[model samples]
Target: MKAPLLLHVFPGFAVGGAQVRFAMLANRMGPRWRHAIVSLNGRMECAERLAADVSWERVPFAAEGSLPQRLQRTRALLRTVRPDLLLTSNWGSIEWAMANAAPGGVPHIHMEDGFGPDEARGQKARRVWTRRLVLRRAETVLPSATLLEASRHLWRLPEARTHLIPNGLDLARFAPGGQGGDGLPVIGTVAALRAEKNIGRLLRACALLAGEGLGFRLLIVGEGEERAGLEALAGELGLAGRTRFAGHMPDPAAAYREMDVFALSSDTEQMPFSVMEAMASGLPVASTSVGDVRRMLPPEQERFLAPCDDVALAGALRPLLCDAALRRELGAANRLVAERDLDQDRMFSAHASLIERLLMSRAALAA
Candidate 1:
């Protein structure tokens, strides 16, 4: 018998949370399931990470035309592929959700990571209405408490249909890193330089630290549309030699190793994998208290998470940067959390079971 087919639709198949999660899941599951990926924006940044053995196809989407036209295109694509399971991610893939609303549609699910800059102010009325209309029939998966609650209330999804699957990581790949060379502590962040990520806020905070005669360097990892703007801001803030803009790294394991501290200055996020990765790498994190970040950190480390701003973020990073002993103490605590709760094997098992259960349900319905 043929293996179950899982079609995943993403706004863009970049090295973001949704894409990375799917890649890791596909690699772990091996030949148990076949995969189809659709990227609306047609960018597959993380495609290199997929296992060589996984049978998968990428259905290209040019993202042309108005709302109705896009929906029609998605529906036509669905009719063509006719996969056993349809998986969509975030608002970018909402049109696919709308496509699934048609009569005799394929069994579908949506995995929401978070919103883009468009919803930075609030969930717009059109989006909320669209989500309510299209998501009624699909099972939704949320990896963070923030997303789960948002799905329940904002999208008005029933609790039963929403699964709160907290994000996990490959802990051993990011096992507690040892001390780097005896140089100044490195303040680093692993985030796509995007507007929502607010990398500028981090740069401003770095300036604040510099003003106080604080001695440290900043490492900005990951690439995005906002890279130029961030670089310009860094120059304006007089953080020239103090910051290194490492465009994009396939493997962030080495980056994490060199960092003495991890910082997240995102104005919007649910469960950032970077923070969890930093934790697993035995780095103390000083970040904004967005999403489930406050809950994700150790109790002792909670004070380090402030609102996304120069002063708040600077205040958060101050203690970690100034005190080496504090970094190690909090870093150890963070490592324990990553190992105890966010193991990748545990997450892979959960997804495998979910797929099996969903496939079984589809079979029963077909009968």
Candidate 2:
């Protein structure tokens, strides 16, 4: 018998948290399932991470036309492909969810990562109603408690169908020990330079740290449309000398291994993979108190999670950069958490079990 086919729909297949997680899981699962990926916007940068042996193909589909036309097209394609399972990611792929929302539609799962800049502070009522209506029968996966609760009470998704599975990392691949170089401590971040990521906020915070005479190097590892604008902002903030924009790396393990402190200044996030990698690599994190970040770190390290403000973020980074002992202490605690809870094996098992169960149930129904 042929392996079951799993179709994954993404807003864009760029290298971000969602795409990277999909690539990791697909690589691990190997030939257990055939995979089809559709990048709504046609950006397939993250596909480079997939292993050569994985049974997967990218579906050449770009989202076009008005809502009704797009929905009709998606539903027609779903009928033609007749996948064993359909996995739609985030709000950007909601149309796919809507297209597959029929009573006997293919076994569907919707993954909610987080909101974009428009809905960063609060979710739009229109979207709330739409999700509540369309995602009623689908299995909903949320990576953070914040989103899980929102899915239950706010979106009013069925309790039984909703799942809270925290994102995980390969703890062994990221280990503690970046020899604190004599030149300057490296404060690093691995995130797509997007508006919602607010890399500019981080740059501004680092500028404040520099004004206070703190010596450190900023290493940004990722690529996006916002690069030129962010580089300009760095120059304006006088961070041109200290900051390095190391554009998209296939693997950011070395970047994490080189950092003394990790930073996240995004306006929104739900269990960002960068923080998990940093923790596994034993680097203390100073970040905006967004999504599940505060809960991800040890209690002692919560002080470093500041509000989304330049001065507050700077203050959070100050103590971590000033005292070497604190960094080591927090880094050790973070590594312990990663080992105990965030191992990729646990995530692989949970996701695989869920997918297999869904495929089996759908097959039984079909039979």
Candidate 3:
């Protein structure tokens, strides 16, 4: 039989959590389906992660014009592609969901990877209503319990159609390794230098530690438009000497191994892949408590997580920096948690089952 075509739509396919997860999924499920990806903003940085054997291509999309006009165009593209399944990512690709909203259109699945800066604090009414209206019939996937709860309470999506599938990591690649190169401890974070990631908060927290004569290196990994501003902020805070912005490491497993502790300062997130990778690498984490992070980490690591404020985050990091034994203890616990709960094989199985079920259901309906 012919391989079914699965078309994925993302707002901008930068190397973020959602895109990386999709890449892992596509790579693992190679040749089972022909994959067509559309990045609305024309950025496909994460495309390199896909294996050579994976049958996938980028589908051109014109996101120009108003919402209604874009929807009309997207519908035309959908009809032309005639995919067996349509998968849309986050709010930016909601218009694609609208385009495929008709009863007889392609089978659709929507994945929500938390929010951007705009809706970090709360959800917008318009978006809630739009999701409620457009996604009633489509399967909705959320990678965090926090987001799954929001889908039911805020977006008012039905329980039956919503799936909570946490992001998973390859535990073997991120095995425990020696940390700290020089005398000073290394505190690191892997995140796109974006506003919502709040890398500035991490910088400021480190600055607070530095002001008290604390000695450590801060390594900020990943690249984005916010790099220049964050670099400037690091300089302004007198952290230029201690901070290193390691931009866009294709394989971040090594990045996690380089650090004694992993930091997440994002104002918004939902089961961030960085945190999972860090845990798999057997590193203790110091982070702003956001999304499912509080739940993802071991109970012992909770003291290291603070509210979204810099001072609070700094307070959380202070102890983790000073105590080597505590870091080792928490790191080991984190690795255990990852091995027990965050294995990628389980995630791959869940996704494969979901895809198979959806395809079979669509075939049944057609019959």
Model 1 bad stretches (over 4 Å):
none
lDDT of 2 by residue, 103-146 (tens): 87889989999999999999999999999999999999999999
Runs off by more than 4 Å, candidate 3? 180-182
The positional error of residue 265 in candidate 3, measured at the CA in angstroms, is: 0.5
lDDT of each: 0.87, 0.92, 0.91
Name the candidate, 1 or 2, with the larger TM-score value. Answer: 2
> Candidate 1's C-alpha lDDT?
0.87
Candidate 3 lDDT tens digits, 198-243: 9999999999999999989999999999999999999999999999
Candidate 2 lDDT score relative to the true structure: 0.92
How does model 3 score by TM-score?
0.98
Q: TM-score for each prediction?
A: 0.97, 0.98, 0.98
Task: State the lDDT at 4 in candidate 3.
Answer: 86
